[model samples]
Target chain A: MRLAEAWRVALDALRANRLRSMLTMLGVIIGVAAVVALVAIGTGTKQQIENQVEGLGSNLLLVVPGRIQAGSAPTSSPLTLDDIDAINRVVGDRSRVAVTIASGETVRAGSRTGFASMQGVLETTPTVFVRNLDRGSYLTRTDVSTGRRVAVLGAGLARTLFADRDPIGRQITIGGVRFRVIGVFEPLGQSLGVDRDGEVHVPVTAAQRLLGTERIDGIAIRAPDRDRIGDLSTAVVAALTDRHPDTDFSAVTQEQILGVLGDILGVLTGVLAAIAGISLLVGGVGVSNIMLVSVRERTKEIGLRKAVGARPRDIGLQFLLEAVLLTTTGGILGMLLGGGTALLVDRLSPVPAALTWWSMALAFGVSAAVGIIFGVVPAQRAGRLDPVVALRTE
Target chain B: MTAAIVADDVSRTYQLDGVSVPALRGVSLTVDPGDYVAIVGTSGSGKSTLMHLLGGLDRPTGGTLLIGGRDVSTLSPDEMAALRNTTIGFVFQSFHLLARTTAQDNVGLPLVYRGVGRRERRERAATMLERVGLAHRITHRPNQMSGGEQQRVAIARALVTGPSVLLADEPTGNLDSATGQSVLALLESLVDDGVAVVLVTHDRDVAARARRQIVMKDGLISETR
Candidate 1:
């Protein structure tokens, strides 16, 4: 028989038992949908994290004391301004090197008070990082050199302390010491789970005096070009290691961070797809069972067809076609459903989701395979039926 | 021209739970085009077995059976099916029409195996249905039709491929006497068109109407007249 006729016959058979066909298809529908939606969510999160990591800065490297591997302890040798000067000499550009010493402190302006993360930074912070000023000027070299008490309020902190009033040149007390605000930074929502707009920046020298600490948290360096980042990292890590021979310094780039994070998220996506595949397996079993029942029910029909002229091959082809048709239809519906769910999630929720063509293709391919794998035994049984015996069935 | 079907000393022994039981023991028969013959017997007397063998649904285990001049033992299962498609048509006692399909599609089924195109198959099926006096009921499913009409539809389905031989097994058994007469008349009408008609029946009245009769006793033919 022609393939088209086989398909028509299969379709007619399915239509004859529309309710049973639909119920049998439901399992595959849910399985394919779950795979598409879950994979979308996983990939979307990976993309979101990548964007945030890249948003930190271009051609940037973060140097932290001690190894950044799992279960590593902090080094006893803290990063000092002398170490910064040593790195500055090697880098040949003072503006590309910056460091920060962080402390959480409460600030007061008049009767208003708010807690904020206080970051002691140098004049070169704005150049080394991606921060932009909304009003007034950022810290100057003279401010850091003279130990002048000056601060830059973040967008959120400025709103809290001064509200409608201008925050630049306003006085705010930090740890019982007063400093004049020199600038207000533009709003930066969040990056790497840190609230950028909730920080207050001060001159490192003045901050050291207020906090009574000389230890620095970390160093940020901007390479001259993208390709030089690796070379520059090696140089800076060597310089820091030279000063503190007992400690190991690690310089991490954005790509390294993204690679590690992408690995974790990729595994998570695979696991979710695997879990969804279990349901597809179950659906395939259901298809096999239903097809067996259909074969049993149509034994007399098989006998009649054989008596008329149908070959065993034709009978087998018809049944196999029926199974493939069932699953492929279910697969298509599930794709629409999964794509719709992904679209809905992307729009209505904070959790990101994106559908890829490959995932859709994979789900479709698997569904068709499910049909073939589950269809074989029943189709063979129908083909191998003894016509005389089958005709004897009522 | 070759006979439509020729069986020479054919025998069929079936295995039931590893024990052999002979259904047809050395029965020989010859049917020519335009012939009308009937095989009559009580249940389990091997008339059905002979019909099945002549239809090419089962091969004879002993002796030679030729359908369309090809020996039954020489044909593969697929070749046997192809021979049946081109040379033989079947009508069952219970009207074995697909329950959910229209009369037209059910009639077109044999052509489907012959690789006939859909449109041509439908046209031929309609023509055959009309020939069986079911022109107005072409679209009706079997369940919607009366017993007589369903048997006519089955006759239409059997004859749709324009085969050389038509095999009817108790074709009128399920119908009322009046309806059975009409169905039997339809089968007789096809023999005039040079198609051999072979009928298996237990009804003496039905057997009397045929041009030839073979009565079987046990697994062998007891009489031919």
Candidate 2:
């Protein structure tokens, strides 16, 4: 028989048992939808991380003491202010260099107390990183030279300590030492999993005296241009290594961090798709089971068709087409459902979700393959039935 | 003209549980165009088996059985199916019309296997339904029609392929006497149009109306007239 005619007969058969057909398709629907939505969420998280990393600052490089490879415990930093001055000479632009000595400390203005990430930094911090002040002036050369007890409060910390009152020029104590708030930073939300607006910046000199430590945690440098980052990183690492012959320093660019993160998330997306594909496998089994029942139920009809000169292949083709029709239609509905869910989650939540074309195509192709793989046995059974015996069945 | 079907010393043996059961043993028969032949037998008399062989639904285990001059034993299953499509039509006692299908679509089924297009299949089915006096009932499903009308639809389906032979296995078995008479009259009318008619029946009166009679006893023909 012609394929079109076979398709019509298959469609007619499915329509005859509407509820059963729909129930059979449900398994496939859930499977495809899960695959699409999960993959979208995974991809979106990866993209979000990439954006935050790039948004840190253009042509940025971070130099940290000790090795940065996996499974290594952090060693005590030997980096000092002298190392920063030496690296400043190598970059030829002192404004491009910055350093931080980070400590968790509690700060208080009157009875209002708030915990903040205390970032001991130089005046060049705003120039090296993407940060801005909302009010008052930032620290200057004399602040680090003379160890001035002046501070800048993060936007969230400023709000918590002073409420509506102006925070600039107010007295706050960090690590139980009295300091004046010289400026309040603009509101910068979470980036690279850190709350930028909940930090306090002071001169490295005062932070060392207060915390009783001369070592710096890390160094940040902004390249003059994107192309100069490689040369600048080599120079900074060499300069730091020259000072501390017994210590190791690694200088990493933003792109390397993104690449590693992207690799990890890519695998995560694939794993999610694979887990969802298990449901599709179960759905295929359901299709096969229903098709078997249909074949058994329509034994006499099969006999009739065979008697009417339908070839064995024709009978097999009809049943196979019915199975494919069920899954393909189910796949389309699942795509819409999944796409809608991804869209809703993207719009309504902070969790990122991006629907990729390849994921949709992969889901669709796998569902179709599921139909064919499970459809073969039942169609064969129908084709191989003895016409005389089948016709005798009630 | 070639006989529509010819069987010479044909035998059919069925295997059941590793034991051979002979359904038709060394039986021979011939049916010609415009002939009306009725086969009468009780259950297990092999008349049904003989009919199945003549319709090309099964091959005889021994000897030659030909439908439309093609030897059944030599033909593959698919080739036999093709031959049956071109040369034979069948009407069952139960009026095995597809339920929930209109009379026109039911009648067009055989043509579908013949690879006929939908428009032409519909046109031909409608014409054949009219020939069976079911023209007015063309749109009615089998469940919506009376037994006699459903049988008429089956008959229309059988004849739609323009086969040379019509095989009816107790075509009127499910109908009332009046309705059975009308359906029998429809089969007899096809003989007048030069088609060969072969029927298997248990009713003696139904057997008596045919131009020729063959009475089967056991697995072989016991008498013929």
Candidate 3:
């Protein structure tokens, strides 16, 4: 028989038992939806992490003044500005690397008080960390050279202290000393558990003078290119170790951090996708079970068709087409549902989710395969039925 | 001329729990074109089994059966199905029209298995329905038609493929006498057109409508006239 006629007959039969067909389809719908949505969410989260890491600046390396031990507390020594200069000298060229130091302190403006992470940086801080001001001007060479107490409030800190008003040129008390807010930073949500929007930037000299400590907290170094980050990190470590006999410092490259994060996220997405795949298998089983029942129920109809000269392959093809139609229809509906669900979750929560074309296609392909794979047994039974006995079945 | 159907020493047996129960015991029969034959017997007399074997719906355990001069016993299952498709048509007593399908589509069903295209199938089905005097009810579903009309539709379906023979198993058993008479008249008209007709029934009146009759008892043909 022609495939089109077989499909038409199959569709008619399925329509005859509409409620049963729909109930059978529900399993596949839910399965595809869960798979699509879960996979989209996982992929979206991984993408978001990659973008955030990329935002931390090109070829970035962090130099911290502590020796991390496996089971013991990290032993720390003070990092000085001379160490930053020593690392720059060891790296050979000033344009090849740039550094910024950061510390935490409290700030007050009017009647409001908020805790702020204080960043002591040079004029190159903006370029090295890839930061830009949302308003006013950034720190200048003269401001850092003369130890001027000019500060740039992070987006969140600006919103907290100044509400909706602009904070440029306004004076805020930091570490019991007043500093002028020359700029306000654009919102940079969160990175590595630190709230980027809640930090304030000032010169290293002014910060040391005001906080009564010349000891630096940590230095962020930006290499000229990504390929040079490892070499630059080794140089910084060597320079610091030579200058400080105790060598209580660690230099971490961006590639190392990203590699570890990629491993963890890759495993996480795989586990989630596998869990969703199990549900699809369950749905396939549901299809097989329902198709078996449908074959049994339509035994007489099958006999009639056979008597009318339908070949065994025709009967089998008809049933197989029915199963595929059910699943593909369910797959389409599930894609819409999954896409809508991903959009809803993205809007309703902080967890990121996105629907990509490849995921949709993959889900659809898998559902079609599920239909054919599960349809075999029932279709074979129908194909192998004895026409005489089947006609006598009722 | 080659006979439309020839059954020689045909035998069919049922195996029930490793015990043999013979249904047709070496029964032989021949039917020619334009023949209107009725096989009549009570239940368990194996008339239905004989009809099934004659229609190529079942194979005989022993003996040779031929339809349209082709040896049915030697044909593969696929070839048997093809022979049924192009050479024979079957009408059941229940008027087994698919529920909710229009009469035209129902009549065209056998043609679908013949690989006829949709447009031509529809045209042929429409002409067949017209031939059965159901042109006005072409779009009506089986449930929407009367018992006699449904039987006419089944007849139209059987004739759609232009088969050489028509096999009816208790075709009138589900109809009233008047409807059964009309159905029988349709069968008679096909016989006049030189199509062989085989009717299987226990109803005496239904069997009497045929020009030739065979009576069966105890798995054997008792008489034929």
Leading candidate by DockQ: 1
> What lDDT is reached at residue A56 by model 2?
78
* Consecutive 10-residue window with the lowest summed lDDT within model 2 chain A: A366-375
lDDT by residue (A1-394, candidate 3, tens digit) is 8877888888887898899889888888888898889888988897888878888787888887776344867554467778767877776655444545556788999888889998887777777777888989888879977999999999999999999998888899998899999999989989867899999989889988986777777777877777888787787888888888676678887677777888898798778878877888888899999999989988988898899898899999999999998888888888888889999998999999978888789888999999999998999999989999889888
Ten contiguous residues minimizing lDDT sum, candidate 3 chain A: A93-102
TM-score of chain B taken alone, candidate 2: 0.99
lDDT of 2 by residue, A1-394 (tens): 9999999999999999999999999999988999999999999999899888987788899999988999999889999898888998999888999999999999989999999999889999988888889999898989988999999989999999999999988999998999999999999889878998899999999999999989999999999888999999988898888889999999999989988889999899889989998998899999999999999999999988888898899999999999999988888888888888998999999989999999899888988888887888999999988888788889
lDDT, model 1, position A6 = 89
| lDDT of the structure predicted as candidate 3 | 0.87
**A-chain TM-score of every model:** 0.93, 0.95, 0.89
Residue pairs with backbone atoms closer than 3 Å in model 2 (clashes): none
Which regions of candidate 2 are displaced past 4 Å? A134-137
Q: Candidate 3 has what TM-score?
A: 0.92
What are the runs in model 1 whose C-alpha is more than 4 Å off?
A107-114, A134-137, A155-170
Candidate 1 Cα deviation (angstroms), residue A42: 0.5
Whole-model Cα lDDT of every candidate shown, in order: 0.91, 0.92, 0.87
Q: After superposition, how far is residue A128 of candidate 2 from its true place, in Å?
A: 2.7
**What is the lDDT, from 0 to 100, of the residue A256 in candidate 3?**
73
DockQ of 1: 0.86
